[model samples]
Structures are given as C-alpha cells and as structure tokens.
Target: MKFLFLITFIHILPQCSGNPLSRHHTTSEEIKREIARYSDIAKAIINLAVYGNAQNRSYERLARFVDTIGPRLSGSKNLEMAIKYIFNALQEDGLENVHLEPVKVPHWERGVESAMMLAPRSYNISILGLGSSVATPPEGITAEVLVVTSFDELHKRAQDAKGKIVVYNQPYISYEETVKYRLLGAVEAGKVGAVASLIRSVTSFSINSPHTGLQKYQFDVPKIPTACISVEDAEMMARVASRGTKIVVTLKMGAKTYPDATSFNTVAEIVGSKYPEQVVLVSGHLDSWDVGQGAMDDGGGAFISWEALSLIKELGLRPKRTLRLVLWTAEEQGGVGAQQYYQLHKVNISNYDIVMESDEGTFTPMGLAFTGSDKARAILKEIMQLLQPINVTNIYENGGGTDIDFWVRDGVPGASLYDDISKYFWFHHSQGDTMTVQDPSQMNLCAAVWTVISYVIADMEERLPR
Candidate 1:
C-alpha cells in the first residue's frame, strides 16, 4: 500500500511541475517587444484622438447631434429617430453594411412627476418615477413617510409600515450595493402594505435633480407606486421625520407601462482583408433616460466609438479581421437589445476575436478589465504596455459590461474599457447628465484610448481564446 501511494504522488508531482501558471508570466522582454511593435500606431491614434483637427470636428458633430436629438427613452419615437440617425451617420462615416436588427423592448412613459412635503418645513422637491413603476391614483397618494436605511430595517419593522410611504434613505456606498434599493425598494415596501415608496437617488452627490432607473415588481406583491427623490430632498425628508413631526408627502406621477415595443440594435462592419471570419466588436448603447439630453450617460460613448472607427478608416488602415460597431438600444430598460443580438448571432460567438464596450461614462480612459484565460490576458497585457505612455494603466480581472454579459457567459472573452468614474455615478441616471457637463479635454483622452484599443484589436494576428 505504501509503495502504491508513493508511485501515485510521484506521478502527480511531475504533472503539476508542467503547470502553465508557473511558466507563463508577463515578462519585460515580451512587453518591450509589443510596445515597439505598436507604439507608433498608438502614438498616432492618441494624437488624433486628443489634439488632431479631425477629433475636434468629430466632437463638435457628436455634441451637436446629441443636443439636437435630446432625450431618447427606450421604445419611444425619439429612440426610433435616434436609431435612424445612427445608421445614417455610420454609413456616412464610410462603414459598410450598416443595418438594424429588431429587438423587443418594454415601453415606460414618464408623463409627469412631482412630490412635496406638506408638514414641518413645507417644500417642493424634485423627483421622477422609476421606470415601470405603477401610477398613483388621479389625486395621488398622500401618506405619512417612514424612513429606513436598509431592507433589513424595513423587514424588522414591517408591521408598522402600513398605510405609510416607505422612504429608503440608504446612502450610496457603491453601485453594486446602492443599486439594490433602486431596483427593488418598491417591492420590499409593497410587501408590507405601504402606500408608496421613495428611494434616495443612488448617488453620493446631493444634487437637487432626481435620478431615475429601472425598477422590478415581484410577482407575489401588489405593485406599488415608486419614485426617487434627490439626495438633498431625501435628507430634508429625513430631517423632518426625525423631529417627530407628521411628514406628509403628496406624490403625483402619471408614469405608466405599455406593451413591449419594437426596437433595433444597429450594426456596422468594416470587413477584414485576410481573416474575414474573425471579428472585433466595439459599441455603446443608444437609448437614454428621458430627463437629460443623454449626453454623458451613453451619447458620448456611442459617438466616440463611431468616431474611432471613422478615424481608423480615414487613416487608411485595413485590418486583418472584421471590425464591427454596434449601437445597442433598450440598454437602459434592460439588456434586451444586447441579449437579442447575442441570441440572433449565437452561432458566431466562437468567431468573435474580441468584444469591447464603453458604457462607463465618457471620462478619461484609465485602462481595461479583461475576462478570459491567462493566455489571452497575457496577450492583452502586451497590448496594454503600448498604451502605458497615455496613462491608461488599471487593467485587472473583471466581467464585461452589462451589454456584453451574454457573450462573456458563452465563453467569448471580452473587455470593458475603464474610465475615471470618480464623478460618473453622481450624474449617471440624473438630469445632471448633459452635454454641458462634459470636459472636452477628458473626452478627447477617452477618444484616444478607444482609437488605440480598436486599432490594436482589429490588427491583431491571433484571436483571443474562447
């Protein structure tokens, strides 16, 4: 028995000795070679993106386009118009085979929304109904407000929440945690027979404009009216309630939901010369919330992607693999557009060389998160070394963005470019997200990063691992 065990251990040790993790590590020599190969191209793309005359022209055109179109909520007529505009713009940008794929999306109308305190220090407050929230009666629901910091606290005192407006005054910690209250606070409040629900805007900044996002209704509970008030208004309500005063809130919202409507995911491709079957995909969503002009939330991202491809073509660089640009719709409502695209093209997942998405607001580019095998990541690190001079240096392991989740799950490795998100969440889903809020210098920096990344992926010799 001892001899048999010794033999098995010896065999396993030799197998473990051949582990790739022990042998395959990023080396300075490899990085230096990659930098030498791509540095000139990276420098050229960066110059054009940040300081070139062409970039200025593109920026002005994009800013004007977003401003003119204004808000384009999912499945709305404005969104349809925006889709058409994007297709035309891509065609004009010299991209071939620009087309739209049909996708079904939910339609939620934000007709009118208002809320105010009726006791203590009476004040009108800015608010907006969360997408998919049920409308209050014609007269609106007036009830004493009950404030809680978390769902656990609400669960603890749920019995006392009857006939009151449950106000979730939870502070924003991170997008992962704060998003829970925005997505499901209504259902939690409704389970306890609350008349309505109001969540503090999911942002750290105390702007007076409310942030709006998608909300979900549980099947077992009645759907209650839900809205979000700005952090300032939420604090004021909390203060009034703390004084032991009967804080009555009058909320009037005409928000309602309609049947799913037809939307489209627009795609434009630059066919490759040698490896026509392999693809490098880049994109941003086209739909935005109804409050602002949708400039920073996604308009900037979409335009930068469009401009990057245009610049690549204008530079007369013909890639070896197909380069595709997608302007997805209904990303705000859900990832319906992305999911539909993935399903419609599931057979091509293996042929995708790399997918890159830029939905993290149009701030200065930092680096990129890679979600793939160590082999693919090692190759990506090589590419990243070329971008180091431009200050894009925060590559790490992470999943792809929401729209690319489908591809990533199906073993298609992808990346979501990182940007300086220090202030992005502040105005992310709020009316504060407008073209006026963007800094041209920072936007230019982002454009530079996008151009380099798109070009590298397009020209790569090997496809990323599946």
Candidate 2:
C-alpha cells in the first residue's frame, strides 16, 4: 500500500507541475494524493520515533543532564558544560557538521536574596530576585509597601508611591497580558518614586514557590532592585494593605552582573542529499534560569530537537535539504545567542527554508503555530493534516519563537510547536521546572511530531515560499 501510494504521488507530480522546482503544480486531486502519501510517510516516521531510542533517551538523558549539570544559566560553567556535552553527544550520534559557534553572553549571579514582612505578623516571604537585578544597599532597605493591582492604579497613586516598595499584585489573566508587570515592574515603580519593586509571579497557578526571570530597567529611569514573590504572599500582603494595615517589608538581594562570558551555540546537521545549501533550521535554547533544573523549560526543547536529528540519522533517512540543529544559548537573557547567530548568518538568510523552535514546553502534540506567507501557510496546513491521527492537526498563523523572531521578521518561513502547555507558566522559571513535571510519553510524542514535520519540510519538492 505504501509503495503504491508513493508511485501514485510520483506519477501525479510531473503531470501537475511538470518540474519539481516549481510549486503549485498539482491539481486538487493530485494535492490530495500527495498529502496522503506524505501522511503515510509521516506515520512511518512517527512509529519509528515512538518505538525508537528517542522515547527513552529524550527524557532519561534530560534527567541525567539536570541531575548532573543542574541549571544552565548563561555565562555559567554549567551552560558551557552543557554546550560541550551536547556537541560531543551529537558527534557521537553520527550527526554531520557538528560544531560550536561562539557567543558572548551576560553573567548574572543570584546571590543571597531575601524578603521579609515586618508588619501584620512577621513572615518570611518566598522570593527569587529577578535576573540582572542590582543588589540593595548592604543593610537592605526597609520601607512601607504600596500594593497596587494594575499599572493604572500605580499611576493614580503616584504620590503615595513615594518612599514605598511598590508591590504589583496584578492578577494573572494570561501570560502575555500579565507578564508586562514582571518585565516592567521595576521601571514603573522607579518612575513613581518607589524605592523598590516586587511583582507577583506571572502565572495563573502557583504554589508557595516564587518564580524568577529576566527583567529590564529602562536607562532613562532610576534603577531599582526587583524580585518576584509567590502568588499567595502577594495576595496576602495585598489583603493586609486593603484593610488599612501598614505593610512594611525589608528586601535584600546580592544579585550582581559580571563581565560578559563566552558561550557557544551547538550546531549539528544532516547534510541534504540534494540541496545541501538550502537549510531547514530546528532549535531550542540551552541556557535557562538559575532557580531549578531547566528540564521542562528547555531541556526538553533542546533534546527533542536533537532527537529529531538523531532519529533521522539512525533511520538512515536523508532529506533533500539540509536539516540544521542549533542549540541556542543566552535565550533567557533576551535571545542574545540567537541575535548573535542572526547577525553572523544574516547574509545567508534567504537560503533558510524554514526555522522552527520548541521553546514552549514539549507537552502533548497539538500541531504548530507558524508565521509565513499565505501560500506557505496553506502548504503547512495541508502538511499538518498528516498529523490528525494523533490529534495534532490544528495550525494557526503568526506563530514563531523569540530566538527565531529575527528570521521571521526577515521573511523567512518560521514555525514553533504548539502544545497543551496549560501548566507551563506555572512552573516556568521556578524550582518546579524539574523533571518531576515531564512525562516520558509526552516527550516521545513531541519528538515524533518534530521529527516528522522537519523531515517532511526538508524533503519536500520545493522550498516553502517566503
């Protein structure tokens, strides 16, 4: 049946397009037949991935990486070691053209940090200093707390913000909506004459754990120390202030930034059997927050991308176009590694056929969110139909990853895996991001989908239209 399907697809190819170089050659029936052929191949790849070493190694290797190496913060020794490990692993896996590309990354260390409530009964508040935050004075600053739910409320009470520690208890509506507080909490509070700022973790659900991530300080505004507190603590303090209770807290952080550290973007490839110069890029960031093991955040992402290449190599399947796997570094620090990579390779951007990232947690497969021209989207939508057997057929437009944003902006076809990440933000940047949250079966399925999609794209008759 598979042979017959391929024969039919091949026979219809020239009749519709006359040449493989030109796209849009197939009639509706030919397109349907081609899609069916691709679907059958995709199922074969999926089966190979599911029963192959990726299912076990993707998770087990990540467990070892997290347990052995711990967090992979940019400019840290751990991240460098991670690059080395992955580079060596890829070479050992028989992936061709494996090497490390240098990137200078920021080094921010989270030293002794603490926050305490002195009023309304003493409580040791759980807090994680935001990455890159400046340390408070040696003695720490003790100030009255000003609680506000929104930036508008802060603007309204600007006068009261003077000499106070602004605490943003912004309720979590969605990650995209609520994350503004986390990113700009310090700048907004500094603008309002606040001594410091603390934002509730940007997650709809949280335990007593405090999540930490990168925060920005506008150069024109006063720099202030900032940290994230657990949702329970933020709400509790908000309640205290609502009852006219004086909320006073002491915050001390030892976070300090050091000189830029040298890092690398790990690269490996399966050279194309035909168009070796035309590249299909698949990637995930290697650097993660300092808090927990970066298992779910991106260990799954990086490894699954590697697994895609590994499965392809082990299966002796070579695409018509090169499949390049990039393990990006310093992504948590505003996509610094990917930025450098883009700068170094922008001249060849046109040769890039597609760039796919999996920074989002690799949960159950749910197709992809893509950003491309309408024609490209149509082709991808049809390709994704092959994945309906696993219920991952849904495809949406305007989807890409932070690392690949530059490529997408340059009009290169870009995509990222879409998964049911309902609990992703909850554990992101927190100690809860360890392997405890990862499911092996889910990781296997994610690897299967990634491998099939990237392989099919690389082996397609023509590159996706820009």
Best model per lDDT: 2
Off by over 4 Å in 1: 1-35
Name the top TM-score candidate: 2
Q: Per-residue CA lDDT of candidate 2, range 1-466, in tens? A: 0011111222122312333456545444555555667776787767776775455778887898888888999889889888888888888888999999998999999889899889877999999999889999988989999999999999999999999999999989988889999899999999989999999999888888889998999999999999999999999989889899998899999889999999999899999999898899999998999878999889999989998998888778899999999999999999999999999999988679899999989898777888876666666777877877677777765678889999999899899988888889989999999999899989888988888889988988666766
Residue clash pairs of candidate 2: 16-25
Clashes of each: 0, 1
Poorest 10 consecutive residues of model 1 by lDDT?
1-10
How high is the CA lDDT of each candidate model? 0.80, 0.86
The sequence of per-residue lDDT tens digits that candidate 1 reaches over residues 84-140 is: 888887888779889899999999997887888887657887888999999988898
- Measured on C-alpha atoms, candidate 2 has an lDDT of 0.86
